[model samples]
Target: MTAITLIQGDITQQSVDAIVNAANSSLLGGGGVDGAIHRRGGPAILAECRDLRASRYGRGLPTGQAVATTAGNLDARWVIHTVGPRFTREENRSELLASCYRESLRIADELGARTVAFPAVSAGIYGWPMEDAARIAVETVRESVRETESAIEEVRFVLFDEQAYEAFARHVR
Candidate 1:
C-alpha cells in the first residue's frame, strides 16, 4: 500500500524520487509550478523539454498526458511533467483532470520512482475548484496505488498555502 502525506511547502524542494509538475502542454515552461520547476531545476530541465518539443512533442503535450525529464538541480532524479486540463463548467473535464494524476503515476512507475510530490494540478491558474481538485487528486492517487503493481511507496501532495493544505487534508484524512 502507498502512504499519502500532505506538506504545506514548495514542491520543488521535496526530496523525492520524482516531482510531478503541473505543466502546460507546450512543455516550454510557463507560470506557477511549471515556471518554478523550470527555474529552480535549472537549464538542464529546459534543455530536455526543448528536446521533447523538437522530437516527439512538436505540437505540445496533450492535456491529461505526462512525460519525464531530468530533475536537474532539484533533489529528485526525474520531474514528471503532466498537462492538466483547464477547468470548464460548460464541459465536464473531470476525467482529464483525473488523468493528470494517473498518467503521472504511470510515468513514475516507469521511472521506478518510489516517492513522488504533486501539486494541486489545475487548481491554480487553470481554475479548477480547490475542493474538487483535492478530492480528485486524493481519490485518484489512492485508486492508482491500489490498482497498479507499482514501486511507489509514498505520494506527497505539496501545497503552497494553508487553504490548499486544508483542502487536501479533508480528502486525505
Candidate 2:
C-alpha cells in the first residue's frame, strides 16, 4: 500500500530514511529548496557533491542522477539529492521533475531505505503551479512506489506555504 502525507514546515526537518533536495545541475547550491538543504546539511554535503559533480556524471546533474550524503542536523540519516528542472523552463520539465521523485526512490531502495520525504519540486524558483505540481508529484511517487524494488512505506510532500500544503492535501487522498 502507498501512503502519502502532506506536512507543513521545513523539508529538512522530516525524519525518514531519506529526504530529497530540489537541487540544480551543479549540485553545489542554488535557489529555493536547494539553498535550504545546502545551508542545513552543512559543508560535508556540498564537499561530497563537488567530487560527484566531476564524475562522468560530472558536477552537472544528469536528469536521473540522485546522490546521497550524510544528514548533518536533520532527523534523517541520509539525504537523496536530485536536481529537478523548473516547470516554467522551456525544456522537458515534466520528465526531469518526475525523474527527481522516481530516482530518489531508486536511490532509497539501493540504500535499503523504506521511508522518504519530498518537497514541492520546481514550485519555488522553478515556478511550477501548485495544482499541477501536486498532481505530478503524487502521481509520480504513486507510480514509482508501485514500480520500484524498494519497500517504500511512505512518501511525504512537505510544504513550506499554506496554499501549497492545501493544494497537495486536496490531491493526495
Candidate 3:
C-alpha cells in the first residue's frame, strides 16, 4: 500500500523521485506553484516544456491531463506537470480536479517514481476550496494506489501553508 504523507513546506524543495507541479495549461510557467517550480528547477525544465509545446502540446495541455519533464536543479529526477480545473459553482468539475492527482500518479508510475511530492492542485490560484480539494486529492490517490499495482510507495502532499496542511492532514488521518 502507498503511504500518504503531508508536509507544510515548499514543494520545490522536496527530494523525491518526482515532484508534481500544479501547472497551468500553458505549461510555460505562471504564478503560484508553477512559477516556483520553473524558477527553482531552472532553464532545463523550461527547455523541455518548450519542446512539449512545440511538438505535442501546441495549444496547451488540457485540464485534467498531465505531462512530465526534467526536474533540472530540483532534487527529483522528473517534474510531472498537471493542469487542474478552475472551480466554479455553476458546474461540477470535481472529476477533473481529481484527475489531476490520478493522472499525476499515473505519470509517476510510468516514470518508475517511488516517491512523489505534490502541491495542492487548483487550491491555490485556481480557486478550488481547500477542504474539497484536499478530500478529492486524498481520496483519488488512495483509490489509485489501491486499484493499481504501482511503483509509487510514498505520495507526499507539500502544502505551502498551515491551513492547506491542516486540510490535507484531516483526510490523511
Candidate 4:
C-alpha cells in the first residue's frame, strides 16, 4: 500500500488518482468546494452531473453511497462524488458525513485508484465546525483506509487555507 500523505494545498491543484467532491445530493454543483470543483472541472462535469441528478436517491443520497464521473478539466483522471448532509437536527449527521469518506473510498477502490484527495467535507456552506469536522474527517479517512478490502494505497486531505490546513494538520499524529 502506498503511504498516505497529508498535504496543505488545493484540491483543484492536486494531481492525485481521484479527488472527492463535497457535493450536495443533487450533485449539480453549488458554492464552496463544490463550486470550485465545478468551475475548474469545466462544463462536462455539470453535463454528466445533470444526467445523473434525477436518479439521486432520497435524502440527496442513500448513506454510504457514491458515484464516479470523468474528471472534466480537473487534474485527476476521475472524480468520486459523494453528498454530505448539512448540519441538522436529524440523527446520524456524523455517521452520514463519515459515510461520505467511506463511500468515496469504496468507489475509488472499485475504479482501481491508488491515491485519493478530499476537501474538508461540510466545513464550508454546510456549516460543520472546523475542529470537530477535522477530527471526524481524519479519523474517518484513517479508519476507512484501514478497513478497505481493496488496493487503496494513499488518502489525502487538501486544504484551501491556512486555518483549515492547521485544523486538519492537528490530526496528523
Candidate 5:
C-alpha cells in the first residue's frame, strides 16, 4: 500500500526521490514554489527548463500537464513540474487539479522514484481555496494509487506553514 504523509516544512529540503513543483505555464521560474525551487536548486534546473521551453514546451506547459527536470542542488534527484489551473467559478477545474498529481506520479514512476514530495497545487497565488485544494490533492493522489501500477511507495505533501499543514491534515484523515 502507498503511504500518504503530511509534513509541515520545506519541499526542497526533503530527501525524497522527486519533489513536485506547482509551476507556472512558463516553467522558467516564478514566485512561490517555482521561485524557491529555482533559487535553491541552482542554475542546472533552470537550464534544463530553458531547453524544454526551446524544444518540446515552446508554447509553455499546459495546465494539468507535468514534466521533469534535474533537481540541481535540491536533495531530491528529480523535480517534477506541473502547472495547475487557476480557480474559477464558471469552470469546473477539479480534474485539472487532479491531473497535476496523477501526471507527476506517472512521471515519477517512469523515473523509478519510490518517494515523492508535493505542494498544495494552485492553493497559493493561484487563489484555490486551501480546503478545496487539499481535498482535491488528497483524493486524487489516493485514487491514482488505487488505479495505477505506479512505483511510488510514499507520497508526502510538504506544507510550508502550520495553516497549510492543518488544511492538508484535515483532508488526509
Candidate 6:
C-alpha cells in the first residue's frame, strides 16, 4: 500500500519527485496553486507548457486529465498538471473530481515519481467544498494505488491551511 501523508504547508516547498498542480484547462498558469507553481518553477515550466499547447494539447488540457512538465526551480523533478472540475450543485461531478487524483497518479507512475505532493484540487478558487474535496482526493488516491499497482510510494496532500489540513486528516486517519 502507498503511504499517504497530510502536510499543512505549501506544495512547492516539498522535496518530492512530483508536485500536482490544480491547473486550469489552459495550463498557462492561473491563480492559486497553478500560479504559484508557475511563478516559482520559472520560465522552463512555461516553455514546456507552450510546447505542450503547440503540440499535443492545442485546445487546452481537458478536465480530469493530467499532463507533466519540468519542475524548473521547484524541488520536485516534475509537475503533474491536472484540471479539476468546478464544484456544481446542480449535477453530480464527483467522478471528475476523483479523476484528478487518479490521473495524476497514473502520470506520476509513468514518470517514475515515487513521491508526489498535491494541493486540494478544485478546493481553492474553483469553490469545491473543503471536506468533500478532501474526502475525494484521499479516497481516490488510495483506490487508484490499489487498482493500478503504481510506482508511487508516497502521496502527500500538502494543504495550505490548518482547516484544509485537518479536513484531509480526517479521511487519511
Q: For each candidate, give its TM-score against the true structure.
A: 0.99, 0.91, 0.99, 0.89, 0.98, 0.98
Q: Give lDDT tens digits, candidate 3, residues 51-102.
A: 9999999999999999999999999999999999999999999999989899
Q: Candidate 3: where is the Cα deviation over 4 Å? A: none
How many clashes in each structure? 0, 3, 0, 0, 0, 0
Question: Local distance difference test, per candidate?
Answer: 0.97, 0.81, 0.95, 0.82, 0.94, 0.95
Please state the error at residue 20 of candidate 1 in Å. 0.4
Model 1, 83: alpha-carbon shift in Å?
A: 0.5
Clashing pairs in 3: none
lDDT of 1 by residue, 1-173 (tens): 89999999999999999999999999999999999999999999999999999999999999999999999999999999999999989999999999999999999998899999999999999999999999999999999989996779999999999999999999999
Worst 10 residues of 1 by lDDT: 142-151
List model 5 lDDT by residue over 1-173, tens digit each.
89999999888889999999999999999999999999999999999999999999999999999999999999999999999999999999999999999999999999999999999999999999899999999999999988996668999999998989999999989
Q: Tell me the lDDT of model 2 at 22.
A: 82
Better of 2 and 5 by lDDT: 5
**Candidate 1: regions farther than 4 A off:** none
Error of 2 at 85 (Å): 1.5
- What lDDT is reached at residue 98 by model 2? 79
Candidate 6 matches the true fold with a TM-score of 0.98
TM-score of 3: 0.99
- Candidate 4 matches the true fold with a TM-score of 0.89
Candidate 6 lDDT over 86-167, as tens digits, reads: 9989988899999999999999999999999999999999999999999999989999999998878899999999999999
